[model samples]
Each structure stands twice: as structure tokens, then as C-alpha cells.
Target: MTDTIIIGAGPYGLSLAAHLKAAGIDHQIIGEPMGAWRHYMPPGMMLRSEAFASSLQAPRSGFTVEDYCRLKGLAYSALGMALPLETFVDYGLWFQANLVGETQQADVLSLRRVDDEFQLLLTDGRALTARKVVIALGLKGFAQTPPPLQGLPARYASHSERYGNLEWASGKDIAIVGGGQSALGLSALLHELGARAHVLMREDLVVWHERPQGGRRLLARLKTPDAGLGRGWRSLFLSECPGLFHRLDPARRRLIMDHSYGASGAWWLHDRVVDKVRISHRTVVNSAAIENERVVLDVLSDGRQERVSADHVIAATGFRTDMRQHAFLSRELAEALSTQGGMPELNSHYETRVSGLYVIGPASAHSFGPVMRFVYGTKHASPTVARHLSGSLKADARQRAPARRPRAAAGASR
Candidate 1:
């Protein structure tokens, strides 16, 4: 049996693996390294977070995104620099090559508790047992679709999370729902790919944030400090003092997280989207139906109802971390854990109610606040989890030793 089994090879999983290995823990890292960024996102896409905040949290400083870019001969400076999605993926590949170099590329079909360990059934027909399991599935099982569009078949409607690129929808008439980065980003990408794409959003206008400038403003720092989350005291607190957020009442923490990062397009995307993609403002999708292999959306705007027809509808509503989406979890094991507010209830160290079964990344947001949902979160989360897990594993070994001692004494008496 291995000391631990990390179920994903994304930023969180890879970072934790480096920590665990450096701490001398026996563990196995599984899944395709950087699979989500490599497959789920389209090529032209850029990360929502700044480049500095988008790297894995390695044990040392050399594995940062800036370091990778410098070594690879890419623009390695400020956040305003246009960093392609491909560049980030290439950086992840580089990070993986140096840390957690070998990975088991199979999927975890199902997971269950066997005695005191987790029995992981893999797609490769291999069964591995581990003293602990870290569910770092990231956004894999969390993509959300609006209930109104649930009835429509895949040919008519789908989520933005379901695509590697929009090339398949080439020359198609598409209607994207929502006003956030995903919606605006996809709309721009689709239009550029020769598709007639339109946006349907309930917001009054499409909003965008100004890019961080090259030089620092000394006066701006007096009012608010810059942090991994962004430039503000609140962002600083959330990124550095996540433990305090975790201690607050769950409701208040939820409120802060919900209000902080309410979706807006990047300034870079504004030039690509404006005058190129049409936006139906203050609009809501009342219902969706598949008619003649097309998506017919009943939309409401300005107290008027209208039918919008498109060859396909993309719901960029984003992901929900509700525990029910964890289908790979065995029923008995899932039922044993506490999921009071759709998200799993985790302890201070990111451990779930089920002992030895830990969760991190977006899955730990409900417990650790918004920081856990971002790549920068790994800076705190990976080292914290690795430290706690190392201690617990040693304790477990000591406990088992007492029982073995009695057996040794019995053999000597014989």
C-alpha cells in the first residue's frame, strides 16, 4: 500500500506531489499531468489569473511561472503581457518534467474505503490501496448547466467546460449565455473562428477590468497592497489569511467569496469582443428546447419576451462544487462524509470528515474560502497538507507498531 494516492495531475496535485516527495512520503501521483489545461481549454484562451499567480506551488522558488518563461524565452515580466494559453500549458509540462516527472495516466473509475485504506479502481484495470487519498479532480466533475437548458440534447446545448476548442462549431450560429469571462471569451473565440456568435447576458452591460500596468504607482500601494488574488487589502487577506476565513461562520465566508469575484471580462478580451460579437443585454434564458436540430431559447429582456434561434447554445455558467457530482465516490463512503452546504465539510488542514480522505483546490473552497479555488492557493495548501499528512502518517505507523510488538513477544515466548 502507498502512503497516499493523488487523484489528479493538475496544479494542485502536482504541487502537493512535490511537497510530499521532498518530505520523504511514499505516494503515487496519477492522471494526465496538466490534462485539464491541455484538453478542456481552447488554444487561444488565456488564464483569468495573472501569470505570476498561475504556477504550481513548488517546495522551492525555481518552478514558478516566471522562471519557466525566462528559461523558455517567453515574455517574463508583468501581468499585462499577453500570455497565451499554450504558453501556460507548455510551462506546466516543464514544471511536471522537473517535479512529479512520472505519472500514472489512467483515470480513477471508482474509490472506496477498504478497512483503513482507500481502494482505488483504475481505468487500466489496476487496483491500488493507499493509506490516504487526495481528491484533486479540479473542475472535472463540477461543470454546471442552467436547469432551463437541461432538457436539450448535446447537439443543441452544451457547457463551455466541455470543449478543447470551438473549431467544431465553425461557421455555426451560436448563442452564448452569461456575461463572465467564459461567455465573452468564447464569444470572441467563436467569432474569430468563422462562427456567428452572439451573447445573452442578464447584466446591464459587458464589464471589463483594466490590465495591471508595467510600472507601479507608489500612491496606490498606500491605499491597498497587491496580492496573489489582486491589488487590495481584501484580496491580500483572502490569500494570506485563509485560516481566519475558514474559522468564520460558513455563511459569512460564502458571502465574501460570492461577492468578491463576480464575473467580468479581461481588458484584452474587450477589443476582441466589442463590435465583433453581438451582446443582448439584460437578458435571461427562460427556457430551451431542441427544434429541428437547433437550440430555440425563449429569452426575456426589458420586459419583452423573444425567441432566439441558434445552431448551438453554450452555457458558460461556470462550475459548481456540489458533492453530488462526485460520481466516482462510492455511495457508502460519500454518505459517511458531511456535505452540509453542497460542498464537503473539511477540517482545518483540508481533511474531510472521512479520516485520511482529503480534498483541495476548488473542492476545498467552501472550507478554505475563495483562495482554495485558484492556482495561487497551492502555495499555502500544498505545504500545509503535506506537513499535516506527514505527521498523521507517522502517527499511524507508531500505532501499528504496538500491535506488531505483541506478536514479536509471542513468537519469542514460543
Candidate 2:
């Protein structure tokens, strides 16, 4: 048995493994590296955050995008600058192969508490027991399609997450929803691929920063730890000092969600994509009804109701943290877990109410602040979680006998 079993080998899982290795902790990390990133992201997309800011954290800090770029003779731009999503995936793979080697491609089907440890049953019918488990599933299985569009036929409607190729929709008129970066990026891709695309959003204007005049000078300042928007008093109070924000209680959390979760496109995508697409802002889809293989949507815009018809409707409306959406989570386990404003509640150290089970990544946003969902939070989360696991395993080691190593040939695949 291993000291810990980490699920979902994305940035969070890989970084946790690196930290555990540095601390000399005996652990096993399962799942494909950057699995969600590889499967969900569009083909030819770019990251909203800068290259330097996006990296897998480890005890040795020098091994980052900055170092990787310099070694490969690539330019190292400041934070908030965009990098192609494919390039970022390549970088993540390189980091995983070099830093963490125990990664296996396995799908965990169910997790149950057994004695003081947890038993993870794999899809292949293998069982592994670990002292603790950390769940770091990324945006997959959490993409939220709006309720209003749920009943539409599959051919006439789909969510952005379901899109893999634009060839199927070539020479067709498509209506894209939402005002976030993904919506704009998809619009740009479809337009470039010979599709007639138009974006509809409820917001009046697209709020995005224009390019900085002097290269990286202004962008770097905004992303710094002590300057600009990210370092302002309000940001600090929400992230660094969460107590102030948490004190408001349940009623306030819902109000904050409505206001804070509003979507806006990224700065890099403004002139490149937003300028090209025809946007009908301040327009809300009133009702969607099918009409002869087309989706007829009744929309309200500028104090007038309008009818629109489209061959396909794609909802880029972002995801929610609803734990019920995870079908694998057993009903018993769901009931046992605590919740905060429809999201799983977690402790400061990323531990949930259930002993020996922990959650990280986007799911842990309520506990560790909003940074938990972004790449930057991995810096603090990985080390802290590893330290906690190390201490807990050491304590349990005194009470149990040394784990017996499974016979290698006996457990080999048939």
C-alpha cells in the first residue's frame, strides 16, 4: 500500500507528486497526465494567462516555464500574456515525464472508506488501498450546460465542451452563447474555418483591456504580487485574507456568486476575435423551440423581442461547482460530505469533512479562496497537502505492520 493515492493527473496531481517526492514520501499517482487539458480544450486555442504564471509547482522553484523557454531558445514573456494551449500542453508533458514517473493511466470507478484508509476500485477490477486520497479532477465532468437549452435535439444544439471539430458545421449558421474567453475563441475558430458565426451575450459591452503600448512593461506590473489589479486591497481581502469575505455567511455567498461569476473575454482575444464577430450584446434568449431541424430562439434585446433561427446553438456558459453532477460519487458519500453554497466545503488545508478524503483544484475554491481554481494556487496547495499527508502517514505507520509488496508477475495483466 502507498502512503497516498492522487486522482486526476492534471497540473494539481503532478505538482502534488513532485512535492511528495521532494519530501521523500511514499506515494502513487494514477491517471493520465494532463488528461483533461488534452481532451477538453479546443484545437488551436491559446491560454488566457501568461506562460510564466502557468507551471507545475515543485520544491525546486527554478524549473518553470521561464527556465524551460530559456533552455529551448524561446522568448519568455511576462504574466497576463497569452500562450498557445498546445504549447502549454507540451510543456506540461515535458515536466511530468522528467519530474514524476509513477503516473499510470487508470480510471478510478469508486472510492470507499475501509478501516482507517481508503480503498480505490479501478475500472479494470484492481484494488489499491492508500492512507489518503486527493481528488484533482479538472474542468471535465463539470462543464455546465444551461437548463433552458437542455431539451433541444442533439443535432441542433450542443455545449462548447462537446465540440471537437469544426468540419461538421462548415458553411452553416451558428449561434454562440456567453461572453467569456472560450466563447470568443470558439467564434474565432469557426469563422476562420468557413462558418457563419454570430455571438449573443447579455452584457452591453465586451470588457477587455487593450494591448499595452510598451511591450511587457505594463502587463508585468498588473500581475505582480504587490502591484496593480491582482494586488489591490480588495483582491488581497478576497484571496489572502479570506476571513473578511467568509464572515458574510450563506446569504451573502449566493449574492457574491451572482456578481463575481459574470463572464468576460480575455484581453488578447479582443481585437483578434471580438472585433471580427458580430455581437448582439444585452440580448437574452427568452425561449428555445425546435422548428423543422432548426432552433428558433425568442430573444429580448434593447427593450424589444426578436426571433432568431440557427442551424446549431452552442452554449459557452461556464461550469458550476455542483458535486451532484459527478455520477460516480455514491449517494451515501454525497450525503456525508458537507457543502457551501452548492459546492463541496473544504477545510483550510484542502481536507473535506470525510476523513482520509480530500479535494483540490476548482472544487476547493470555497476553502482556499478563488485562486484554488487557477494555476497559481498550485504553489501553496501542493506543498501544504503533501506536508499534511506525510505527517498523517507517519502517525499511522506506528500502528500497522509494513505493507507487503504485491507479487509482480502474479498481478501482471492476463
Candidate 3:
């Protein structure tokens, strides 16, 4: 049995592994590194966040974009402070190779609480037991495809998560929903790939924040517990004291969740994509029906209803937190697990109500505050969860000893 088993070797899982290894904890990290990001992200896309801000949590050996560019002899541009998605993936792989070498490239099929441990069943029919388990599965399984558009056929309708290659629909007329970053990014990508795209957003205009001036000084302030773009008491409340945020009444939490989703995209994205795409603001797609190889969308723009035809519709509607969405979780286990609002409830230490089980990343939002859903939250969660696991392992060791024959009994038997 291992001391701890981490599921999903993405940023959070890998960062936790680095921290656990640095603390001399005996653990195994499993699942594909950057699994969701690799599989779900659009090809040739760049990350919205800065490169320096994204790194594994290790004392000195963590992988960073700067290190990656230098090592690979690739020209590193400081433009926009963001790294290409491909570069970020390469850097992640490098980090996994050097810092988290014990990770297994396998999918976890199911998990069960067995006594004081977790019995993980892998797809290859291998069973592993662990004193503790951390679920770092990212936002892949939880992509929130809006329910209203469910009736449209798959050929004429798709979610932004299904966009692995925009090139597949070259020269096609596409309608994209949502005004958020993903919608804008998809619009830009589709346009670049020679597709005629129309972006329909309920908002009055495409909104985004300007990049802060200065260099590392500005970045340092942003990374602080209560400063930069993540300022305001709400941001601080979520980042610094997540437990308190978790304790807020359900109505208040819902209000907070709605308020938190208001933040928009990067300014550069507007310059690159929004300026080029045909943007229809204050517009909502009322309903969709198929009409001979085309999607007839009943759209309401500025209180006027009209029909628009497109070969495909892409809904950039964001994700929702519902434990029922996770297919790997058994129906019995899903029902047994406690929930807050619609999200899975977690303990102060990031563990679920199910003993010996823990969750992190987007799945931990209801417990660890709204920041748990963002990529940056990994910085705060990885170290804390690692410390908790380490302490638990040490305490468990003291409370339980290996089974051994008594000295008298051994001698007599021999």
C-alpha cells in the first residue's frame, strides 16, 4: 500500500507530488500528465494566463516557461506575458519527467472506501490501496454544456469543449455562444482557420481587463494573497480564508458564484480576435432546430427575434459543478457523498465526507472557495493538501503497527 495516491497528474496533482516528494512522503502519482489540457484544448492555441505565473510547486527544481524556452533553445518572447499552449504542455512534460518521475500513465476506473483506506481500481484491472487519495481531476469531465441546446443534432451543434481542431470546420459557417474568453478565442481560431464565424453574446459588449504595468513587481503583487487583479475583499476572502468562504449561507454562496463569473478576458485577445470577428451583442439564442444540414437558430437580439442558419453551433457556456457529472463515480458513491448547493462538499483539509478521500482543483470549489476553480488556485491548494497528507501519514504510522508474532510464541513455534 502506498502512503497516498493522487488521481489526475495535471498541474495540481503534479505540484502536489513535487511537494510530497520534497517532504519525503511515500506516495504515487497516477494518470496522464496535463490530461484534460492535452485532450480538450484547441490545437495551436495559447494560454490566457502568463507563463511565469504557471509553475509546479517545488523548492528549486520546478518547471517554468522561462526554463523551458532556454532548455529547448526556443525563442522566448515576452509579448503578452502568456505562453503558447504547446510550450506550456512541453514545460509540463519536462516538469513531470524531472520532478514527478513516479507518475503512471493510467486511467482510474473507480474508487471505493475500504475500511480506513481507498481502494482504487484502474482500467487495466490493477488494484491499488492507499491510506489517502487526492482527486486532482481537472475541468474536463465537468464541461457545462447548456441544457437548452441539448436537442440539436451533434453534427449541427457542439460545445466549446468538443473543439479539438478548428481546422475540421474550415470554410463552414459557425455560430459561437458566450462572450467570455473561450468564446472569443474560438471565434479568433475559427476565423484564422478560414471559417465564417458569428459570435452571439448576451452582454452588451466584449469586456476584458488591461494588463498591469511594470514587470515582476506587478506580478509579485498579483500573486500576493490579497492584491492585483484578484483584489477586493471577496477575492481575499476566497484566497486567504477559504474555509470561512465555504461556511457562507447557500444563497450567499450562489450570489458569490454568480458575481465571480463576471470577470472577462485579456486585452490582447480583443486586439487579436474580437476586432476581426462579427460580434452580435445583447443577443441570445432562443432555440435551435435542424433544417436540412443546417442549424436554424431562433435568436433574440436587442428584443427582436430572428432566425439565423449556420452549419454548426458552438456553445462556449462554461462548466457547472455537479458530482453526478463524473461518470467514474458510482451512483451509490455519488449519492453517499455530501454536497453543498450543487457542488461536492469538502472538509477544511480538502477531504470529502467520505473518509480517507480528498479532492482538489475545480471539483473542490464548493469547499475551498471560488478560487479552487481557477488554474492559479493550485499554488495555494497543493502545499496545504500536501502538508495535511504528510501529517496524516505520520499520525497513522504512530497509531497503527505492523502485525507481528509475540517473541514467546515465535520461539515456541520455531
lDDT of each: 0.87, 0.75, 0.76
Which one wins by lDDT: 1 or 3?
Answer: 1
* lDDT by residue (tens digit), candidate 1, 1-414: 999999999999999999998889999999999898889899899787887788889888798889988887877765776668898888888888887779999998899998899999999999999999998888887888889999687888889886796798899999999899999999988999999999999889877888876467788875777777777898899988878889999889878878877778987898999999999999999998888878889999767999999999999998888766778789887776637745888888989889999988988887887888789899888998999999999999998885544346555754
For candidate 3, the per-residue lDDT at 311 reads 94
Q: What would the per-residue lDDT of candidate 2 be over residues 9-33, giving only the tens digit for each residue?
A: 9999999988888889888888988
Q: What is the C-alpha local distance difference test score of candidate 2?
A: 0.75
Query: Candidate 3, residues 312-332: lDDT per residue as tens digits?
Result: 999898887777666666666
Instruction: Extract clashing residue pairs from model 3.
Output: none
Give the lowest summed-lDDT range of ten residues in model 2: 224-233
In candidate 1, where is summed lDDT lowest over 10 consecutive residues? 402-411
TM-score of 3: 0.88
RMSD per candidate (Å) reads: 2.6, 7.5, 3.8
Cα lDDT for residue 185, model 2? 84
Q: After superposing candidate 2, which stretches have Cα over 4 Å from the reference?
A: 212-233, 236-258, 401-414
The best candidate in terms of lDDT: 1
TM-score of candidate 2 against the unseen true structure: 0.87
